[model samples]
Every structure is written in structure tokens, then in C-alpha cells.
Target: MALFSGNQKNTAQNVYTNMRTYLAQKDGAVHVVLINSFSQLANQVFKCDEKYTTEIDYVLNCMQREGYEILDIKFNSIPNQGMTGNRTGFNTLITYR
Candidate 1:
């Protein structure tokens, strides 16, 4: 089964350690799929920093390393929902097909 680590801060060393644990255990036996979006990355307006970018890339890279396919979607505008869709959240979908 796929698992999501609750959003938390991890030191550089801890990130690496957790990744190693996940990879060593998954080993291609299960279809590991990490679903995330460019929108998610762009949403960190307040926590904007080098560390944020690095951590985002780290998770993405780890997902890639685990043979998970990454699909990026782009949206032109927000839908009728009363929410800030400026980050492209309105244009993404994740499907196994």
C-alpha cells in the first residue's frame, strides 16, 4: 500500500534516511505512485526559500527513483469554486490510467 508521510519538516539527513527506507522496502514489487503537482510547489508563497525548493525536489526525485510516474498538469484559469486557483490547482488530475 502507498503511504504518505504527514507533512513535516525533516533535516537533510533524515530525508535521505527515510528515502532509503522506502526504496529498500518497495523494490519494484508494488506499483509505487507519488501524486503531486506543480501547483503544490507553487503554493508555498510564505515559506519561499531555497530549503523549500530543495525539499520539494527531493520528494519528487525520490518518487521518480522509486519508478513512480510524474504527471504535470497546467490550467489556464480557476474554476467556479471560490478559491485561489492562481497556483494552477484547477488544472491537475492524477489517474492510474
Candidate 2:
């Protein structure tokens, strides 16, 4: 499992590189949880500049090229207590033979 909180420091290239490294060490199902975008409150709370965001499709395509099959994609959200509100994200299930 991989979780990316959409840190402003993380670029799409960084994510892809990390995924490649992870895939190299495994040969089964992979679960990826990524913060698609952050809310205004989340941005302030997390001190994120929103300078970089990962393109879900782009990441998936890179994975597919590495021989992984896309199994499922799901949208998810988490409710926060006060100011941050709900955090929206996505889950991707993939498998490699």
C-alpha cells in the first residue's frame, strides 16, 4: 500500500519514480491511496502551496506500461473535526502477474 497526501514538494515525476521502485520489489496486488486535491482549509492547515499535483491518469498509464492491470478505482473522503473539513482522495487497485 502507498499513501500520498499530495504534499506540495512531491511532483508527478517523484510519484512515478517512487511507484516504480515499489513495483520492482513486489509482484502482486498494489493499493494506492492518493490525495487528489486539497480543500482550502486543508491547504492552510497543511501549509501546502498546491504547487504540484499528481495526475491520476498519468500515474495509472505508467503503471500499465510496467505490466500491471488496473483492477479498480474508487473515490473516497474523510470528514475532519473542525476547520479542515472533508478530505477527498482516490484509491487505485492494481495487480501484476
Candidate 3:
């Protein structure tokens, strides 16, 4: 809805920080699900519905920067044509080794 506002970035950073904390709490390697609600909002804002894809790319970069090994990322199937109610939602599953 709003152009990359400070609060938005902060929220993402906060989630990442929490993720880091969660990872630190674990004794061994971990598997995580990273949901990019920002990209979801972007889809709704721009009416493009491609936010999931873009967010996955961003997540890939983040993982690379953080040096986390990726197992897989779940993605939303494009809303079926002529139907909004049937929209399939998704989440990413990432594994760190």
C-alpha cells in the first residue's frame, strides 16, 4: 500500500531478527518457514499478484548473505483465472545445515 516505508522495513528486519534468535536457540541445524507478507501486500497493492515470486528472490539473496543453506521455498500458484476465492496460499521452507 505504501512505498517501502520505514515501518515496513523495520517489520521485516524484526522478523529476521526473531528468526535469527530462534535459530540461535536451537542446538542443531534448523528448518524454517519464511513468509514474506510484504510481497503479499505488494501483490494486493499493485494488482500484479507476483509478489510471492519476487519475495522468493529476495529471500534467496538474504539466505545467501546470511550463509544459510536452502532446502526449498514454497510458492503460491497464480490465482486461477477468473477466480479470486480459490487463490492458493503458500509459505517457504528453508533448511540451514
Which candidate should be chosen as best, given lDDT against the real structure? Answer: 3
In the range 42-95, model 2's lDDT, one tens digit per residue, is: 443655323323455566677778676766665544445334454543343444
Better of 1 and 2 by TM-score: 2
lDDT to native, each model: 0.41, 0.50, 0.52
* Regions more than 4 Å wrong, model 1: 1-48, 73-97
Candidate that beats the other on lDDT, 1 or 2, i.e. the better one: 2
lDDT score for residue 87 of model 2: 52
Model 2 weakest 10-residue run by lDDT: 1-10
Ranking by TM-score: 3, 2, 1
The sequence of per-residue lDDT tens digits that candidate 3 reaches over residues 2-96 is 45444555565556656666553334566666563424442444465454444455555665677666666555443432234444455556655
- Pull out the clashing pairs in model 2: none
Please provide, for model 1 over 18-85, each residue's C-alpha lDDT reduced to its tens digit, 9 standing for 90 to 100: 54553434333433323232333344366543433454556556556756664552224343332554
Ranking by lDDT: 3, 2, 1
lDDT comparing candidate 3 with the true structure: 0.52
lDDT, residue 81, candidate 1 = 31
lDDT of 3 at 37: 48
